[model samples]
Target: MADWDDGYWWSADGLRLHYRDYPGEGLPILCIPGLTRNARDFADVADRLKGRHRLILIELRGRGESAYAKDPMSYVPLTYLQDVQLLIDELKLDRFIMFGTSLGGMITALLATSNAGRLAGALINDVGPVIDPAGMARIRSYVGKSISYPTWLHAARGIAETQTSNFPDFGLHDWLAMAKRLCRLTPAGRIVYDYDMAIAEPFRVPGGGEPGVDMWPVLNALKDIPTLLVRGGLSDLLKPDTAKRMLETLPQMEEVVIGRVGHTPTLSEPPCIAGIDRLLARIAAAG
Candidate 1:
């Protein structure tokens, strides 16, 4: 097993972005976390892919150990694209693959449109050009909310229960790992996750009032780039219909659906991982 190495890269605005690298000699794969998530979210998948690819998991600004932006509005997608660019430059990677979940998927879409030359391929997990408003509202409810738990185990239990529908087969260890990633022990021994609550302000303020921006043009812009879209079978966020639309528009793209999951399917699951492996194989064959 490869040991995870931790580090940080300073963004152009001076916010320190945290990341973890699992070293390998093959292609570099950059994994971007969802909104309010961090590098640790990819721990399981990264561990599995360690021998085949150099896994780089980034803790987007305002999440994980990354420094929060003073201007909360900067938390938008454009800022995140710049952050990815800086991280690539700092690591001296000329080209790379992106594996993004949810909000991270949006970032990947933006980059695919804006910097296609720097990208080799992209894996978008449970996100598309059109976002579900109900899903957005559900996410807003928890993004910056504070939760108090008496113990790490208690927090883990809470997470497991709330996420039971999505991960019915996950064991205690999975919960424990999730709790550790989502929360940190304070000097007083209190556990808290690393994130600025204000990071949720913009979305909450926007409320589901608008469809936000139309991303079809952005999606169409990346038609030539090799792409894969993974959707959780039970996901309310990325509807199956939209996935079909994506496949129709991007004829060369690959798509997969993980059974019994919702919102997003962590690529760690066997089915999802197999799909990703196939995508990588195609990329290798092309090269």
Candidate 2:
């Protein structure tokens, strides 16, 4: 197992946020997970890269050990960007590689536009400037629901049942592993989603789903930065055309698509691992 310390920092609003800091030499890799996900989502990556390069796996507010926001409206991407910025300042990180997935990828895009100089490299996993409506509807359908299962097995089975199409190759063991990452064992002995349910309130409002703004300009800001784009072959979120446009916008960007998965890749897939290694090497050589 990779050695890591539980790190904490306060948000501007005084909420205590958490992260997993795996210490090492050289430039650190700052990981930002998907919405409703937490630091554990990057455990595999941490284990692989531990002692080679530092890894900071962030738990965005309301997820993992982070303090939940009293105001649900604060769950927006810009708010998330602010929270991440505070952490960067707290760590005094002058430059770092960003590995962002899903909602985190959106935040990374915003960062690229706002402060491109701070990024050493970027790995955008399974997301693009334009989100597909089908994926948005699918995510909205289950994001806020309060559901629990009696045991880990039951929780894994529940996820397996509902997400069979998304992860066609997932076996019972795979589902159980995913469940361990996405759900928590409560004091009452039930297993439940790890995030604050209130995080979904913004989605309920009209025109509140994925941001309506054009994000191409935000993504284009990465043109001069070293970047790697990872996609899942069955992904509904990042369609083929959108991925093509992203490459067009940043023609030098490297890409890899994991087969038989949708919406996101766990970053542990062999192809993704290789692509990330290549990206990291390029960043190092540039320095």
Candidate 3:
């Protein structure tokens, strides 16, 4: 197992946040996970890359060990960006590589646009500037629901049902592993996901439900940065056409397509590692 320390910091609103800090010798790789996901999502990848670079896996407010926001509206991307900036400042980091997945990828895009000079390189997994409407709807359908399971097996099965279409090759072992990462076993013997259900407030409207944000400007802002984008073949959130558009706008960007998955890819996937390596090399060559 890769060695790391559990870190804590306060968001601007005084809510405490958590992150996993894997200290290493070279450049840093800060990982921002998908919405509603916790830091553990990057465990496998962190372990693999810990030997080469420092790894920081962040838990946004309301996820993992981070303090939940009293005001649910604090879950927006720009708000999350503020938290990330605070983390970077607190750590005294000058520059680092960013590895973002899903909503995390969107956050990374905004960061690239806002402060592309601070990044060594970046890799966005299974996300793009123009998120597909169907994908957002699918995310909204289950994000705030109060769902629980009676046993670990049940929870694992639930995860399989929820994600199998995106990960068609996943077996019992894969689902079980993901269950540990996605859910927390309560003292009462029930299994619940590790996120605050209130984080979904922005999406839930009085009559229309959750609304999506426009991120075209943020994506266009990453013009000069070296970036790698990953897409799942079965993904509904980031369609191929949008990915192509990203390539067109950010001429300096590259991409990798993973087969048989839906929303995102684990950074440990062979192809994902290759993409990361490509970005890392560019970062090294720049210095």
Point to the candidate with the largest lDDT: 2
Would you estimate the TM-scores of all the predictions? 0.92, 0.97, 0.94
Clashes per prediction?
0, 0, 2
Best by TM-score: 2
Off by over 4 Å in 2: none
Alpha carbon lDDT of residue 183, candidate 1?
A: 79
Clash pairs for candidate 2: none
Q: CA lDDT of each candidate?
A: 0.81, 0.90, 0.85
Which digits, one per residue and each the tens of the lDDT, describe model 2 over residues 1-287? 64999999999999999999999886899999999899989999998998889999999999999999999999888899899988988898888889999999988887767666788889999999888989989889999899999999999999998789889999999999999999999999999999999999999888675655688878888898789999999998999999998998996698899999887899999999999899989998888
Model 3: how far is 11 from its true place, Å? 1.0
Model 1 lDDT per residue over 12-51, tens place? 8988888998998878999998887888778888888897
Q: Candidate 3, overall lDDT?
A: 0.85
Q: List ranges where model 1 is wrong by over 4 Å.
A: 169-171, 207-212
Model 3 lDDT tens row, 132-191: 889888888889788899987898899898888889999898888888888998889899
Minimal lDDT window, size 10, model 2: 205-214
Q: What is the model-wide C-alpha lDDT for candidate 1?
A: 0.81
